[model samples]
Target: MKAVEYRLPKEFDKSFIVFKEQGLYFPCPWHYHPEYEFVLVNKSSGRRMVGDHIGTFLEGDLVLMGPSLPHVWVNDQKYFEKENTETADAVVVHFLKDFLGENFFNLPESEPLKKILNLSNRGLVILGHTRYQITKIMNAMPRQNGLKRLSSLFEIFDILANSSEYELLASPSYMENTRDMYSDRFSKITEYILRNFHRDITLKEVADQANMATTTFCNFFKEHFRMTFVEYLNAIRIGHVCKLLADRDKTIISVAYECGFNNLANFNRQFKRLKDMTPKEYRKALEAEPMIA
Candidate 1:
């Protein structure tokens, strides 16, 4: 159960680097920089692996990733189907944590900002009004220079620091072990779980796949992923349930069985626990959304 490891740069430069990516889907290999990253996904949809957090990311998503956290954005294969035609754009701003210097946190006036950055240790995903503001700022960043760029970058952080609508994605363990095992372990475990979630997967089974003892695997999994093995499995099942609910042809009972629940009652309970809604309610909500091609 090796964890993904990354190296951080030594120096903390005050300036920010702006990157504009076009037609690019897959992110850089699992890696981390010493500098904090503000990412605005103008157009893209795919799975994002940030530290131990895993989830689907849609276009117009905005996130603020803390410094030295292993992360990658994997684009959906559909994006590459036509080869040269697919175009996805992203604006990324990277700056050193010390860019604001020691006084940034020392000053009482900056307490709120410090609190937000501190919260980022657990990994934050900005949404709602704050995300919209950050996206606008990031979109304008590449066209600006010097003091203007600096101001825009600070404004983005200010939005993040003050927003209550954001969500924490990564677990506490991910915050503690910024440099964990190797990237292959994460890929291996993720692929295995995705393939075998419909079947009975025990701790021993997963540990065997990683060539580690069951106990060691549990500790490693919990440390890096911030959840027990069973909890992670349940989350995968719940995600599958969401997909099934969105399909009009699948009945709730059939979906529960298909998702590997042994009993309908247990499935209903778990679904409600994870989703905070009954299966029917979840489907109704999806039905209300505009269809995606």
Candidate 2:
């Protein structure tokens, strides 16, 4: 079993730090830290895991996460292949709550900012006009220093605190202190599930991998994932199936089996259950929208 890595910022005297990174892939694993983070993905597409939430993120993705939240952006396999020409790029900002001062948020005028900070504990995905606006600021922060950079950060907070164009990434009931989630048993189980969800996985096999009885494994999975094991596996499959459905060439039956569904009836059933629409309806919605190639 592998452990979720914990990371710390390099020893520095500053109140905050910003990084502009470009690489073949995002190398960070499931990890958490004490500093709040603002990350802007300037290039590449990938799966983003924030707390118990899992979804795909594209270029121009921007998200804010509060202290001690587990998160990572895992690039697709193509990004790591030797012959791939593209690179992944991002701008990340890290700061302590007291970056301004220990009591800055106690000021009467800071109420709005305080509220935004509190909501960020569940993680925030900047959207609509706000995302476009922040992309510029985040890209510029890596070049500025001193008061100029600090002012830019304050401006960012002001924009986010005032806008309604954001969504919480994690659930309100999501356990933030995931020490138990990072335990050796849970880590091994998660690794196995993510790698093999598209195959015929039996409860007994996974339980054996976790060195737990099947019943104990089921309870443990529900406790951490907030869903039944079958539900979690279906969600992972449906997420990938949605991705494949984007290609107009793939038939529904083929896509279903490709994503590991053994039967069309079961595939359509779980697809609608998780996505609230049948595969055909989902494809129709996609067709109606003029998606950019």
Candidate 3:
């Protein structure tokens, strides 16, 4: 089935809008819109889906999603149970890419904002102190008016555009799938892979899903993604491994196997190739960094 579901704001009097939502859970379904969105999960834990990427999001999760990038935060099953009393809350800011003016982003001084908007096509998870700062700004946006609101918005963009502590959410290939057919096909491929990547996967099986021969699929994937199928699979596995590593209780070897690596040697090789460090080293780096609330 096609995955792109279009969405629109409640009204259209302004170019920029902020929405505060608090409910039993986040109400949006899997959908996309023309305006870019900055979302802060003020209070809740859930599975966040952005483009082809999937991961758990806890309270304080902050993300910037580019225009037309599909996303949703599905609360955990526990949140939906009748006995559950917790609610989900979020602050969302939506603005068009050219909210300032048609030529705004084209100006020399706007280069950084342009780069950030371009990068957001893949979605971005704002991190560390930047995320905390953004939360403060977002919370204050509704109370401010006129130039103050505009200036704060610019500040938010500036911080996000220049920050190093952010993670790209989706693969470049998935974000670049613009054609209807190609978009649907890639979405299917990604959903399948994310669901089954923990198990062994073969090029032959994925090619069959794409309705192409193995060699044809190989060439097609590499041409569009600039990475071989094996490379892409390894990248996905490594991403999951990174998340797993955050849990101090899980051993590195166990995390490797759980992420679909059959052997520690291959896992370490791929991890170093993609992450530039071994699993243990990555864990050490995480521990070394001061925890941000």
| lDDT, model 3 | 0.78
| Residue-wise C-alpha lDDT for candidate 1, range 239-269, written one tens digit per residue | 6776667678889888888878887787888
Clashing pairs in 2: none
Instruction: Write one digit per residue (lDDT tens) for candidate 3, span 1-293.
Output: 12356555644555588878899887776688888899988898977767656567999999998888877788877777899899998889888866778888778878767767776888989999999899999989877777788788989978876787788886554454233324577667766777888889999999888888999989988975568988888888887787678789999989999989998888889888766667887676445311110
Off by over 4 Å in 2: 1-5, 8-13, 175-293
lDDT of each: 0.70, 0.78, 0.78
Q: What is the lDDT of residue 133 in candidate 2?
A: 87
| lDDT measured at residue 233 in model 2 versus the true structure, 0 to 100 | 83
Evaluate model 3: give its TM-score: 0.62
Candidate 1's C-alpha runs over 4 A off are 1-14, 82-84, 177-293
TM-score ranking of the models: 3, 2, 1
lDDT of 3 at 120: 80
